[model samples]
Target: MLRMLPFLIVLALWIWAFIDCLTTPEEEVRHLPKVVWVIIILLFGEVLLGPIAWLVAGKQRAVRGPRQTPWAAGDTGNGGYERPRGRQLAPDDDPEFLASLKKDNKQHEDMLKQWEADLRRREEELRGKDDPDAGRRG
Candidate 1:
């Protein structure tokens, strides 16, 4: 196991370099085209030359400070920064959606009131027809 450590380390480095080369954006790659870097890494990986070259000169790696919000990344339309990962609001939690729902509820309530008033008026008319002398008695 101890003897295999060096080989394992080399293998891991080769794999990491290959993946990094492939995943790194085309614009970020420096000194050579991204495709060339990939070919180099694959071709010279056994000797540790390609991986080392890639790590040293393949891409422009930004120095990270504390975790930054996407806005703080200072994206200047160059696709060089991360975007915000804001969570979506639920419908009930959305103020505009809730306001619309309240407006619909108010309209329905108004219609219900009108229907109730019309029903009462119809009932009164029916009673008047049933007892033509009701108003005369009063």
Candidate 2:
């Protein structure tokens, strides 16, 4: 039972990954070809290929319109953020607003990195706990 447990768990994970890959759109999956993804699903199995696909070849690039920054939302961390009282804001040269926008973007990037690191830590912990000889190699 103990020996078979790992195999069963791995098989389950492979099936789940394969299903997920099948559902993901070809356009959204990057790096590898769509056929390669299928082969990964079929050949390497989920436990290995899922993470590989995600890390090395995932998430198609997208073009987007102008971003909405905190500056655009009328929030600068400074004591007072001034929007044009009369007709309109000048097209450019708003230092305070631009600075705030840059700060917001940096913070968001930092948070995303932290989240990825946290998730990686959790996965490593789970894998470590599952190590077969951790209890006693003797």
Candidate 3:
């Protein structure tokens, strides 16, 4: 069990690093491209070097400071930066966004209906061609 402890620690660190690398946004990834970082983490994670490098440089670590938004300056009452506002609603939750999505979905449905009608017409025309007696019978 003692010998397995080291292996377990390394495995845990490797998993954490790999997950961290994958979840980190491309814009926040530092030093190397997100793809390269993923590769490095996979290739060297077992040796501890990959996880160490990733923790050190893969993602941009947020400094311990207040958040700043475009609307407000970083200044707070106590000489520290002010924290920004809370997160905004997701697109799906926004009424305007949902409306726009509905509009697009409607448009696509109309287009699909039209296409289906055209296909049916074309299929009928082919059937008419195949049966030379169709016109005569009509």
Candidate 4:
């Protein structure tokens, strides 16, 4: 087992480099094309050169800030979930969506009221024709 440690470390580094190269975006690859970097890593992985080269200079790695969770902005009164910055809100959570729904509902109600009025007018005309005395009685 002791004799295998160095080999295992190199193997692990090779595998890590291969995966990192594959997962790196094409636009983010530096100094060489992404495919070339992949091939280099695979070809010289056992010798530690390719993996080291890739890790040191093959990719343009961004210095990322601390990650923010959905609840990082506090409860927001929305089941403890807050919309991430620059992300779209769900329809149910969007004020604009609710406003549009209310506007549609008002339009529908107005249309329904107009239809009911028209129907009542038509019924009154039909009743007058059936019995000319109907309006006189009312």
Candidate 5:
């Protein structure tokens, strides 16, 4: 047991550093991938470089958006900013307004799906073009 003291000290140091890394907010935390973060921390020691990682790693939310202008175009009826239907619907609400929301949501979802599919297809094409015989078994 006495011979393991050095190893235990190393383990304690690692635990302390890792906790410091996690306690930090995600946004403030460095955006680099895990592998990169590991390399940086390991290459740099606690006395000299440990503070760098502690300084990073925290959530950084975007600034609040500007308030919407009531007079904005398309927001009101008769060429003014008009609230879209269903925004203030009662329990017994307008079917047409609900339909509009459903349509808009469906369109958005469809577009997102299409974009994801296109990305996958492009990636596959790139792999195939880069090494035409990459998958061949010899």
Candidate 6:
């Protein structure tokens, strides 16, 4: 309550330059057109010259530089802006998804060795039938 510190610092710089000129991106809105810099930060917002001319000439910011990342900086063709090439990493470091997971683990080990040779030929016909006329043929 210190005499409303310069009207709360000009209402937090007119709500941070009207939310940074409405999230600054209509192609980096420069000298004037993101709907006339949101109607000059809502009509000369209280008088700090339209949030100081939208934080000095409304937007065109960029200037960042170092952290590459478009898949290890491949696409140098900045115009079309491709950039994506390698270093993505997962799916077990993807060499064509680990060669289609080693050809589906060799077709699931040849269908588990033909279902363990049809469960050992159905356990050798239930252990060669012990004798009920050994499956009826005298």
lDDT of 3 by residue, 45-84 (tens): 8999999999997889988888655445545634464553
Arrange candidates by lDDT, highest first: which order? 4, 1, 3, 6, 2, 5
Note the Cα lDDT for every prediction shown. Answer: 0.89, 0.71, 0.88, 0.90, 0.63, 0.82
Error of 1 at 44 (Å): 1.4
Which scores greater on lDDT, model 3 or model 4? 4
1 or 4, greater by lDDT: 4
Candidate 5 residue-wise lDDT, 1-138, digit = tens: 999987676666656665655565545555775445555655664443543553445223456999866556654655554666545766458786788889999999999999999999999889978986976842
Looking at candidate 5, the ten consecutive residues that score lowest on lDDT are: 51-60
Better of 1 and 5 by TM-score: 1
Clashing pairs in model 1, backbone N/Cα/C closer than 3 A: none
lDDT of 6 by residue, 15-53 (tens): 998988888778888867888878877888888898888
- Give the TM-score ranking, best first: 1, 4, 3, 2, 5, 6
lDDT score at residue 62, model 6, on the 0-100 scale = 74
| After superposition, candidate 1 runs with Cα above 4 Å error | 65-97, 100-138
Worst 10 residues of 3 by lDDT: 75-84
Please identify model 3 stretches exceeding 4 Å from their true place.
66-138
* Per-prediction TM-score: 0.52, 0.36, 0.49, 0.49, 0.32, 0.26
Better-scoring candidate (lDDT), 5 or 6: 6
Best by lDDT: 4
Clashing pairs in model 4?
A: none
lDDT of 2 at 60: 58
Give the winner by lDDT: 2 or 4.
4
